[model samples]
Target: MATPPDWDRNATWGGSNGGAGGSRTPLRQAFSSLSKSSGKKTAQSLSASGSTTPAHPASRSQSPAPEQGDGKPTVASDAGLADDLDNKAKLSLSRQSSVSNKSGAGSAAGRDAGAATAPKGDGEEDTPLQRALKNPYHRPLPGHPGNLTTSQAEALLELTQLLLKDGALHDPEKEPPSYQETQLLRFLRARSFNVEAARTMYLKSEAWKKEFELDRLCEEFIFEEEEAVAACGWRMYFHKVDKLGRPIFIQDLSNLDTTKLLQTTTPERIIKKFAVTLELAVRHRYEACTLSSGRWVDDNMMVVNVEGLGLSTFWTMKDQLQQLLGVLDQNFPELSGRVQIIGAPFMFSAIWSLLKGWLPAATVEKVDIAGSGYLPLILKYVRKEDWPKHLGGECCCSGATATGSDGATPAKGKSDGCLHSDEGPWDKDLVVGASPRPS
Candidate 1:
């Protein structure tokens, strides 16, 4: 991959002067540029990959799912907003190119791509977790014993309401007030139950999409940096889904040439690359699920190999790392369902700890630190055949084992101090600062 040599040349976020953990936007009014469509197009166009392609219609029709447990599609709103939706993105674009797997590398994170989001019905034992996946925002109060925690429920309510107000939605079919059950909960969780913070985060996301005219960007964008990404040795590729049903992503962060990386690609390109990749993956999986089982699941897991990480390597891209985290947190919200960190060096502990502060408490917690038994930890969620032998799996990629991640020293805790339980909304310990217990 020929690295693009103009990465640092792009303008940084003039939007905020705040560094890592600073006072972000004040919700009711987050960023000043809340509406990127407000004529900065020409000014910013010179800075970004400005598309001359006209903007596509931002709103579209929605296919109502069963109003969760009520067994009916949500009733149309008196406001007629029911006709405008799927920032579930259920609405389609006319493009033919499915974001293909020509990505740089692979991991055992693959799943049935055709995975469905089916709710428990007759003969199917319904549990809180199962219900949450079906529709965590659905009613019956989510607190009727074995239901969602007070924090989780309230967080969803606050964040979803914000999205709805901002015109983002996916709601209950037949229910009257299951209200704005948008898929924005992941962002809320990522902020550790901070409604205002979550709201600001999501608003920035919306603003970004609008600025880039993302609906059309996804329909027309093509990420040709595959070779450059591969050259970085930190392969940012998509693999199959995991058995537990999340798209798998693999990146070996240690081997990349940070100097080359910075010299070759701008932050805008990196952000766009990640965004377009995600759009393709989500659309691909959504289609696969709808076609195969008439359902939808949108989330993924990852394998990050830190084999060669050292203080020097860490310092080299420290700024980039900070930028990447901010961009992803604001833009990619809740997409990475889980992460497995392998090939961790003693230096890994420091970097991990630092990075954790930048990430939402929920995201940090879901991070699983692999020990000497890395393969087993991975195999628990991903099958052996799904991964390549380099990672201690039985899978053969393109007839050869791609040497990837290796090595790990177990962190002191069974839960690894990374994330909360994946069980469901029933967890009270789900909140940050809650005591960590065995998984």
Candidate 2:
């Protein structure tokens, strides 16, 4: 793997960011970068990119008003937060800690509902993502030092031994007979390295995958309403990479016509679309990126544009949105590098109030909201060449015409436009058994 990028050695979760270093536990440090204040126009420096260390806004003395009844969001409190420099270190995985739902923030309920409600497979055609899931494969995780501190390395050793002894690491009937370190570490980090908790979560997630036949969904299911959904201005697709080589997932609600979307597709299909995309990311995008970037690229960066989203529209889709969040929190833990929400409109605060409640506390921390002047802020993490022209970048995947001198040519198959192109390094010939691209 390529050498991990350089980050400031001194900027830890507590020191340069906020909170008392020693007194702060993993949970506290996870929330350390979150400012109590909201509705501010200024950009929050929440980038976990290895290339920069810009100043972040100070945390307010008074805790910000909770988006829900209690201030806590619904996800697990493991140190999977984006801004914490040493996120792995902040994982206070001690067995005695009060952090609940180590399997996931709201996974128990989700799992139960899934088991009861999930449709049994009828031997439909399988999808590529599903096939990939069933086949045994191992790939390096995010090739970065952030995954392992000296203590984390030791903790990893301990966790591995415990899982091994428990006979939880291998399951020939349900899963492959072996596992990868990267895979194990992903769960351990999510549960703050609590051996028993990580083991339980791992087992439960595997069961959930089997019960839901997630692999089959990924392999066979295709959104018949994909074109219609895009025509309705609900954009969700992989575009490019950030400065640190993480793939960028662009979700534009600026032109979303919620009514048309509802008329065209059902809530169940929307959720399925999202799940397929996520599984693809894990099976294809993440692996391709890891191979191309010469670094383990496990997570992706999100860019959400909510310029025209209004309170009414938000309220109309609130249920669907919460269901999506629940799916993410329950199934895919710690898979985001950062979730940058840009082009926030006047009613965004109200929207945020409703939205934060559905998000996990760890995920809420990874989110960085910007009302305006977001182009420059977003550029800090995503370079102009990789970004789309609509987002104020040089690349014009719409085939209009390339304008920048950065040599970022319009991606092929421009007829589909940028959102539909699904363009990124993963498309290059370097992913599958080829040599790593030059970093």
Residue 432 lDDT, candidate 2, scale 0-100? 21
- How high is each candidate's TM-score? 0.54, 0.59
Prediction 1 TM-score vs. true:
0.54
Q: For residues 274-309, could you state the per-residue lDDT of candidate 2 as single tens digits?
A: 776776666456644443332345678888999888
How many clashing residue pairs, candidate 2? 10
Q: Candidate 1 — which residues are off by over 4 angstroms?
A: 1-162, 168-182, 286-296, 371-373, 398-439
Worst 10 residues of 2 by lDDT: 38-47
List model 1 lDDT by residue over 1-439, tens digit each: 1112321111111111111232232211111121121233322221122111112122113122222342111222211111121222232211101111212112111111111222223544222122222221111111211123444555555566676777654322211121112245456545655778878877777677777765565555554554565456555655544553344677657566777776677667776767766655543332222222112234566789887778777888778779878878778776665678987877778888788888866577568786446877776666677664455666544423223234222122211111212111111211111111232
Which numbered prediction scores highest in TM-score against the true structure?
A: 2
